[model samples]
Target: MRFKPLPADFYLNNTVEVARQLLGKTIVRNYGKKILAGKIVETEAYIDKIDPASHSHPGITKRNKPMFEKGGIAYIYFIYGNYYCFNIVTERKGKGCAVLIRAAEPIEGIEYMKKNRGKTKSVYELTNGPAKLCLSFGIDSKFNSISLRSSKLYIAEGKDENFDIVTAKRVGITRGTEFEYRFYIKNNPFVSKSK
Candidate 1:
C-alpha cells in the first residue's frame, strides 16, 4: 500500500514520545529511479540541556544547527571519523531536540543497501546499527538539515504489529547513560545493540 510522508506536526511532540512512536515508521529515501526504504526499529531521544548526551546540551554549534530547527528535519552527523549517523529533529523550533535513528529493518531496495554496505552475508548486517543503517541507505552529511517532509527523504507510516517495545539506556555515550531514552522493538534482530 502507498503511504504518505508524515507531516511536520507529527514530529512536534515531546522528544521521548516522538522517539518511542517512531519505532514502526518507515524511512524512505528516493534516489532517482531507485528507492531505499526500511522500517525504523531503534531510536534514542535527546532533549537539549535536559539530556546530557545531546549535541545541543553544550548549546548550538555549526554542526548541530539542524537539531535546533523545527521538527521534521534530518540531523545527520559524522562520528568515529568514519561513519555517518542519522537523526530526526524533534520538538518545537529552537528546542534543539532530536531522535537518533539507531537501526532499521530493510523493506525495499535491499540490493542497493547490500551494495552500499558491501555485505552479502545477511540482511541483518546491512542496517543493524546507526552507522550501518546510514551507509546502507546512502545517508550522509549531505542530508543534514534536509526536511523529512520533502520528497527525496521522508518517513512513512508502517506496520505496528504486535511487537513489544523496549526501552533502555542510550549506548556509546558517556553522559545521560542513566536515562532510559533508548527504544527498540523487543527481540528484533535489527536493533543496533540490544540489551
Candidate 2:
C-alpha cells in the first residue's frame, strides 16, 4: 500500500475533529538506523488559549514556539527531565492548537522498536504511551517544529477496523480537570493509562 503523508489541510482544522479522525492512522519515523511505525489508537485535543491545562495557558515561549507554527509540524517537548512528549501542530499558522498522540499500536520494525525500548518484549508496551513510542522511534527535541509532510516524521492512512470511540478527561494534569478532552478507542489495548 502507498504511504503518502497527509497534507497540511488534514491538520489545519478543528483539533477535536482531527483528534477523532487520527485514530488508526499510521505514524512513521525513520532514524537512519531503522524505521519505526505504528497505528495511532488514541489522541487528545489541546486548544491552547481555551484549554486551561495546555502548556500555553500562561503564554508562548521558546518551549512552545512549535505549537504556533503552521499545521503538519511536530511540537515535541521534554517532560520529567527525560521523557519526550510529542504533539502534532494543527490549525492555521499562529493558532496554538495541537493533537496529542496518546497511544499507538506498533505496526512496522517491531524488533527495532523492541531494541530501542531495551526491556520491552510485549507488544503492549512497545508504543503504548507518548514517551514510550517516541523512545521506540528515536524522536526527541531534535524533531521539534519539524514538518510532518516532508520530514522523516510522517503519518499515513491505515486500516479501519471497527472500533468504539470513548471520550474522557485528560490525565496527569492538575488543571482543566473538567474539560474531559481525552479520547481513545474503546477496549483498545494500546491506549495510554492517562485516559
Candidate 3:
C-alpha cells in the first residue's frame, strides 16, 4: 500500500483514536536542506481535562495554546524545563487534547539524525525518547501549532508499518500511568526500552 497521510479528521476526532492510528505511521521534519523522518513506534493519549493527568486540566495558557487548536498540528512543549516533548493536537477546534509521541525508531535520514545528535555508535539514543528525538530533529516550541501536513514539519507515510499494536500503561505520569493508554508495535525492537 502507498503511504498516504490520514486526513486532519483522523487526529481531530479523539486523542486515543489518533494515538492508536499513529502506531505505524511516519513523522517527518524538514529542516532546510535535510528531512529527518522516522517511523512512530510509541505513543500515549491525553483525553480531557477530567483525565486527572492532562496538562489542560489546569486551564489553557500561552504555552499549551497549541493543543487547543484544530488537530493535525504539532504541539511541541518542553517538559521538566529541559526536555522537549512532542505532541499532536487532537479533537476539533477548542478541544485541549492531544497524543504524546513517547518514542520513535529512526527509519530515515540516518546521517542527519546522527549529526544532530552528535553520536554514531548507538541508534537508540537518536530517537528512543520523546525529548531526545525532538532535540535530534530540531523540533521546539517554535513548531507549536504548525500544520502536520506542512512542508517544514509535516508527517507522512514513509514505510509499511503493518502489525499488531500492543497496548500498555503509560509511564512518567504522576496520576494516570495505569490507564493503559500507551500504544506501540508488538515485539518491535525499536518500540522502546520498556516495551
Candidate 4:
C-alpha cells in the first residue's frame, strides 16, 4: 500500500498532544529497495524548560542540537554506550521539544526488520521499545537532524482504526516523574511497557 507522510504542520502541535495522537500513525523507513513500516504504539513527550528530563533542558549542544531545530525533523540519540532512540522534533524552531517514538507495531517489511533486529523470538520483540525500534528500522546518528518529510524516514498516515489511549509517567528517568508524558495504545502488544 502507498503511504503518504504527515504534513509538516502536524509536528507543530504541542509535544504532549503530539505524543498521544501519534499512537496510530505509521512510521516508515526506506531501507535500500525495501520499505519498513510500523504503527506507532507508544510515545513520550519532553518539553524544554518545563521538562527536567528533557535533553534540551541543559541547552543546545552538539549532542542535542536536533531537538532545537524546526518541527518535523528527526532527533535521534545514543544512550548507555549503545542503542539509538528515535524522536520527532516538535513545536517551532528553537523550541527544544520533541516526541520520542518509544515503540511500534511492525506492519510492513517484517523480514527486513527481523534481519535488522537479529534473532527475535516473536514479532512483539522486534520493535517493542525505543532502542529496539531504532535498531529494527536501521536508525542511528546519521538519521538525526534530517527532515521527516524525506522518503528515507517519515511518519505516514495509518489505517483508520479505533484504539483507546493510555497515559502514564515517562519511564527511565529520575526527574519529571510528576508529569505523565508517556502515551500508548491500550492493550497494544508492541508497547514498550504497560502500566
Candidate 3: misplaced stretches above 4 Å?
A: 1-4
For residues 1-195, could you state the per-residue lDDT of candidate 3 as single tens digits?
A: 233666767786768888988887888877788767788888999876767678876778888888788888888887887879999988987888989997788876888888877754588777878887887788888888888877778666646546888888887888866688889888777666753
Question: 56-105, model 1: which lDDT tens digit per residue?
Answer: 99998999999999999999999989999999999889899999999999
* Per-candidate TM-score against the hidden true structure: 0.96, 0.94, 0.91, 0.97
> Quick one: best lDDT, which candidate?
4
Where's the lowest-lDDT run of ten residues in candidate 1?
A: 1-10
Local distance difference test, candidate 2: 0.85
Error of 1 at 31 (Å): 1.9
Residue 192 Cα positional deviation in candidate 1, in Å, after optimal superposition: 1.7
TM-score of 1: 0.96
- lDDT of model 2, residue 46: 91
lDDT of 4 by residue, 33-131 (tens): 999999999999999998899999999999999899999999999999999999999999999999999999999999989999888868999998899
Best by TM-score: 4
Model 4 regions lying over 4 Å from their true place: none
Best-to-worst TM-score order: 4, 1, 2, 3
Each model's lDDT: 0.90, 0.85, 0.80, 0.92
In model 3, the Cα lDDT at residue 70 comes to: 84
Which parts of model 1 have CA positions greater than 4 angstroms off?
none
Worst 10 residues of 3 by lDDT: 1-10
